[model samples]
Target chain A: MSLDKEKIKHVAKLARISVDEAKVASLTKDLNSIFKFIEQLNELNTDKVEPLTSILNQSLRSRKDEISDGKIREKILQNSPKKNEEFFVVPKVVE
Target chain B: MSNITNLSLSEILKSIKSKKISSLELTQAYIKNIENAKKLNAFVTTTFDQALENAKKFDNKPNNEQLLSGVPLAVKDLFCTENVKTTAGSNILNNFIPSYESTVTKNLWNNGAFLLGKLNCDEFAMGSSNETSFFGNVINPVGDHLVPGGSSGGSSSALAADLTPATIGTDTGGSIRQPASFTGTVGFKPTYGLCSRWGIVAFASSLDQAGPMTKTVNDCSIMLEAMSGFDDKDSTSINKKKETYSKNLKDNIKGLKIGIPKEYRVDNMPKEIDELWEKGKKILKDLGAQLIDISLPHTKYALPTYYIVAPAEASSNLARYDGVRYGYRSQKGKDLIEMYENTRSEGFGDEVKRRILIGTYVLSSGYYDAYYLKAQKVRQLIKKDFDDSFTKVDAILTPSTPSSAFKIGEKTNDPVSMYLNDIFTVPVNLAGLPALSLPAGLDKKGYPLGLQLIGKALDEQKILNIGYAFEKNCGYKNEIKKWWS
Candidate 1:
């Protein structure tokens, strides 16, 4: 499970983080070592075991479709780094 | 009232009710103490002026109907405070003020507790030591150079240093208990879903849980009661009535069955920690309790499993922070994708980036079944191991940490070695059980060692009872020597 620069780059791309070329070598080493540590889980025989989603053993409770919140549009927009009135200002996505 | 900050939460409540001390006086004392303990770096944001203003309102007419009327406490910055900056200890959320308060903090306010400030924590609550914080590492109050264990490091440090009477913290894989172990404070992570998680910054939504950090076990119980309840906002919040834990602190452990997990005997464990475990067993055994040897066979996989699951969830949860509606936005980036990449690249710290990468890799198409799915299935096995053991034993006893607080830079370079610090405490979180760490005794370096008592799901009262008995008989209390001052 030795992770290479290509794998690290792919994962970083998927995570939307750009790793500098200078730091890529060390980051690759760290991720490889972490994967090496995690490889021990392969030894466990989990053939029939179900993937655990919630530990509370309670099913998700659905509420009626209604707008209970959103009166604080101004307050919510106050945290935006770039904003115009109520809309969050972002770089143009569509050309 | 000279040493008002020295009094426990219960004592403070009594004094405030009896008119011996006003909320304004108590809050001002804590504000001064926070200033004095500035070197510990426990607080990320101190709301002393707001605290005083609320204290004035409380002094005018104390609300006896509320449980913690006029009590002062610090909240871990992860919990969003309305109109106040809630940094999850990351530059990403440096100026991210919440429009609404976290349900737990709201519960505290409804109980009449005043917020002293926002405490520091690891970036996104990722690291074991507080070193990953964007603010800085919180130094252990016991020794100036040592780390207060994290990611609830600030919460524990503040309580131990008397900067706050009690504090709130979240534990996703030992965040609350480990820091309490390092700082010689009491931290209780109740059953997952016992406290509402609405409005707290998400870090592993499934594993993350809110709890109390305090000077004494009784105070932890009281704070736990005040902070816990069902919230319609958080779907995971338990649908149950809140237990009056402070009133249920029965120290009589006559004929209770305590389990000692043999798998926790790791290789090259410190002699002091080993002796502390033995001492805990003896203390329980002497108090008319039976000690049973139990095997949590999947215990060895807990840390790896937690690392996999938590990061996988964190990567998904953190995807929301793409610099559009929040904290730091990169100045350079022609298009939206570049902006997202650059903003995240610069906003997150190294540890956070590492976890995100690991999560991305694990959840990737080809590797999904091998890593994430396997870890989840193993998680079930781990939980089953606890479920089987609880049928035989009333509670489990173990050392809170492998050793006492280490030097600040000791394990910073190696992430795996740092992750091993949560070994003993992570299993409890994976099982979604309640556990408390009590200051048991001092280690060889004269720093405090903690004894942890693990209980079954929603059985916080049982473990708190065990911790109460241990706290009374352990004869260990933190006597702050004012090292930070």
Candidate 2:
């Protein structure tokens, strides 16, 4: 129920966020406190209850599969931190 | 003309229509006030030039038929305004400008309302206090050094200080209502899917909703009608005929059954908040509404469930922010994985990182069943409790917050203490129901307090009507001094 330093590091890795070595202890403590508070939910029995995913009782509304609008690649790429001719630039992955 | 900024959103529209004041004059007055009240730190970005140009255009060729003709309003930065920066109060998005407009803001502009600025908020709408904002904490206009409740603190502060005629803020979990309660203004969170989420910077997909923060209940109704509608872009948007909230607003609660949930009386609740609830009930009774004692047994689990579900969704939504497409990217990373890690670490604030980590932890393979799944079931129970209570009562009444506005840095170190501030307001979001917070009285420290009205799903009119009645009978008026200037 409590998150240790190792587990905190692991969670950060899973989240793709790098945690500083010095701040790991404090982060672990904060997560543990929050989990301890969240542990109160264990008191209730939910064995047969269905998870409520959406609040609306209606089923998802569907529309025709058609392109509504497009053709503005430059506008779409305008906010990119790094981009070139028509694609976003990122650090190389494939060796 | 002397105090144009003092006019309500509704009054401003009326003046513009009657030619008593041109749109340019109204916009100028608000800009002047915003310039003088920079100490409040309410605005993250002010669009003064754009606002003035639009006001001049509106004055030259007025359109009085629109719902919000020639009105200038500020909105939370969480909403993406095309070509204008929408930070969501994070350093990662500090320089990012949107190419497309959010459905809600677009709706405002389409109805003849122009943008005044983007107000500050908790980063990705995560924190209970505005301290989580990368732009810095917004000072409550009511008092010196008082914390304006978050993540819609900027909207509440701006509205309270008359910097904006009215504003809209997104509420994932008590963001709009809590700040409104803290600032003695009116804030309403419409039913889930009542407002489109398209183009909004997502925090928690299921729980996030956009609503109005205004100086009065009438303005809240007017603004809500203007800002909410179904959009094709947001799949979750409710496809129903939009109600004329302003036109149908009536204080007729002759035989309406209002629920008084005893479970909301939490341990260690301040005496003034409890007294505020009682005063609210007395006002309803005086308005000829019957009050019934109701039990929402699962009310206590709302906050814990919220912390889990919201983060889990946030982690999934925020994964899109990795350094590839948009937003901040780390120059130090040599490879793609390292780039994402470094970017997130350097870009996000402490509170945002904490939530993302908590979200990551809950949804991890081993803990998914125990944490995320269990929390969802608890969420079901919480919603069911409201479902059962509503069969007997038309709406529910509770205090908006446990206490009035606290000093800055009072509970920032302790996250749970900060989360507890939304204990009374979070349940409404969990159930996806409508709720409004109206200033009812002041605490012993003279800070304003609010009482909430919870309505059934898609029943915003009911709550707004009850709030309208309460506003008439409570006779509470906020006397905020202009000390920040």
Candidate 3:
């Protein structure tokens, strides 16, 4: 399994992860090996096998019988790096 | 040692009420253990001041029936504790601390359980080994430099080291159960949504569920009572009326129909695990549980299917970590896009990035039908296998992990080798079944072997009862620290 340096960067971009030019060489090797391992899984005869999604076989357990999230608003925003009275502040998303 | 660690939470609370051991004394003992057992690396962040303050509050409260009052407990780093750093084992969120507390944690704290610290885990709750954490991999205290299993590795490691009496952990896939298997403790993942996920960092949303890891089955049941409740904050939180889980600890194995799936007897299974499985079956048989051969034909697809679906969800869930609103922000670059890329690139570990890309690729428009859609359908089929098998049995039994804990750095180099560790356990998660891993016996290398019991939905009581019965007759009683040495 060969992962080109450029492909590593491309995958990183798609995945929203960062990789430096110097680290690209090693990541390529590691990523290729990972795919190779995944490749071994390809050998299994999963033709008729169904893919498992969740441990539970039931429909999603949901709650809508009521609505109340009491208190703790101040507790929730207290640790933010930047916070206004009731809002979280961030660098402007727009120009 | 005040013997509280050995005692179940029920017994610990009773001791505290009797004034035999003060909350302060118990808290100090656990803190001391954490300090001395540095190599175990269980705690990523310690909260001594918070623990003392909470202890005082417990002393003041009426406290009629809190199961874990003043009992020191570890919190997995993935769960957001108010004002605490919850990096989810990722460097990207190193500076990110939640202004909010996760519901499960707040529930535990409200029940007067003392907070020991935030336990280490795999990065973003990914990977099989604990090595993916930015804080450094947590070590299994039971072996010669063996690894604690991931995602919930830290909590399992802590309980094994007796650094904390109990810990809260998230099991997305087999994070809680497999690590518990490796560490020789009882790790339980309740029926999905029994514990609320609000303020817990999302990994694979559909699969993530927070549960307890403790030294014994009884402590697990006690902690679950406090940790579970309906939460509007988490859309998936089940609204079953809150009930004490400890009421189910009868430990009677009579008339229990146990299902043994033949598919788990795969080629990669270790010989010792086969012996251990036979031993566990014989014990249950001796206790009068009718063991029957069953089939879960979709078992072979669980690993591949889990990888596809979990990563698909992870790609979307992790998208919230851009450098904009919170967490780590890369320094100035040409534009905002560069900053986002740089920060994430610098922040995430190798395994996390791999999953993210893999998740994105599978979920992308061109490949969705082939990868993500196919995986979801297969997942339903896997659940169907369990449902079909459950009709013939009360619970399903299997080895929690194929082998006991391997040495630290043993399987980290090969991602697939690490993924295989979750093979037996992941299928249980995909089906959203309640499961528990308890110490069954020891491998030839003297490592602990864990036995898992998977039960149908909301059958947590059934599985816990079975596990408690297994733990009662297991040879590890009173020999935790000594047996490992």
Candidate 4:
């Protein structure tokens, strides 16, 4: 159940975080220790127990389709790291 | 009058109403205290100018209906303040200013409270110690080098140091209560969905809850009332009338059954903490409450389940933080993928990155059932244990932390040891219940130790009353020796 270096790197990639090669060994060690601690859950028999989706035990409440929140395009885009007049600027995807 | 900075919230409110003290003058005093306590690192941003301007407006015509008229309070950086930088203690959102306000903060403003500033916290409300903050570690006012228990560390420390009259903090698995415990202040985490989560940076949507951190239990009660209500924006927000908790805060605990969970008696718990728990049980007993031994066998699994669920939710929520949108972006990326990878790796701290990896690993293809699904089912068992215990007892009592505040870097290197700090407090969050930590006694080094009172869902009143009873009879004075001053 211990996480290997490859698995750790894969997880970092999946999370979109770039871990340096030097830190991979330590991260793998830490992840493996954590997994070892988490392995204690295997002791219990959860054959009939249902996974808890919500602690309140209620289904998601629906709201009517309406523009309750709008008119903040400029405000929302103000914090963008790289934005032009109307769109976010990014590296060329097509090229 | 005594120093204006040292006055309680009730006293400040009363003085402002009676025209004995101007709100502007009172706010200036608080601003001065915040300035003097700069070494504590309690604030991420100080809104002194805006606070003064609002104080002047409040002074022009004090609204009778406003419960917190002209009160200056600090908010944890987790809650967004419009036109103000809301960095949830992470460098990732260091520059992310919200155009809209968090519902809880909006409620506070509507009730006539002015923001002193946004306080520091654990990045994304993740850590138990404030050292994980990108702003650097918040020093505990109790001692020169101790950590103010976190996620809500800045909130608790600010209140303890009199830097702000009161502060608002969010609790996801003991973030609010633990900091309050470490800093000798009052912290309450209301029932999930009691306060709308809209605009607060989502860490773990299912577990994160907004509540009040204050100097006294009475302040905690009223502040929670002011900060909580139904919001159409937050899907999980319960549509219920806000209960006036301060009005119903009765100290009568006669005939009430208080449960002391036997499972909480873990191995190698400090003697002082064990003695404090016994003292707390004795206080309830003397107040005519029957003490019963109950069992929450699944308590041991709470931390592991929490680590699973929280990070799983965090990984999903934080997916929006790509370099293109907001926050920090790396300059050395070759393309979009490298930009995202580099931005996240550079923006997030080691603890945040670690959690995200664990979350991604668990929710990945083959490990989902073994890790994520099993954790969720275990979470159910933890909640059920509370339900079973509550059927026999009206409320539960336990030590707020395994130990009092520790040195800044004492447990930082070891993640597992740091996670153990929330052992006594996480089970409440798993059950979506209300809980509070109150100053009960001082440890050997004269640092404050807190006793936690936990109650069923929406039973904030019960825990508040029990806390009120204890505060009156426990005779624990949380007054520090003004080290920061």
Interface RMSD of each: 0.9, 0.9, 3.4, 0.9
Q: What residue pairs are clashing in model 2?
A: none
The native-contact fractions of the candidates, in order shown, are 0.91, 0.86, 0.45, 0.78
Q: B304-327 in candidate 4: lDDT tens per residue?
A: 888888888889999988988789
> After TM-score superposition, what is the CA distance of residue A24 in candidate 3 from its true location, in Å?
3.8
**Tens-place lDDT digits, model 2, residues B151-192:** 999999999999999999999999999999999999999999
Output the worst ten-in-a-row residue range by lDDT, candidate 3 chain B.
B476-485
Quote the positional error of residue A9 for candidate 4 in Å.
0.8
Q: Which parts of model 4 have CA positions greater than 4 angstroms off?
A: none
Q: What DockQ does each listed candidate score?
A: 0.87, 0.85, 0.38, 0.83
lDDT tens string, model 3, B356-405? 87787677767776667777777787888988998899998999988888
lDDT of 3 at A36: 57
Backbone N/Cα/C clashes per model: 0, 0, 16, 0
Quote the lDDT for B452 in model 1: 90
Kindly list the per-residue Cα lDDT of model 1 for residues B1-485, writing each as its tens digit. Answer: 78988888888888898899899999989988889899999999989889999999999987877889998789999999998899999998987888889999999999999788999999999988999999999998888999999999999899988999999999999999999999889999899999998999999999899999988889888899999989999998899987999888899999999999999999989999999999999988888899999999999999999989999999999999999987889998889888999999999999999999888888999999999999999999999999999999999999989989999999999999999999999998888899998888888889988889999999999899888888888888777688766
Candidate 1, residue B148: the lDDT equals 95
Which candidate number maximizes lDDT? 2
Q: Which portions of model 2 show Cα errors greater than 4 Å?
A: none
Candidate 1: CAPRI quality band: high
> What would the per-residue lDDT of candidate 1 be over residues A17-91, giving only the tens digit for each residue?
988999999998888888889999989889999999789879989999988876788877888999998799999
lDDT of 4 at B292: 96
Per-residue lDDT tens digits of candidate 4, residues A1-95? 77789878888889999999999988888777777777888889998999988888567799788777777789879999999998999877777
Which stretches in model 3 have alpha-carbon errors above 4 Å?
A1-8, A25-95, B60-64, B478-485
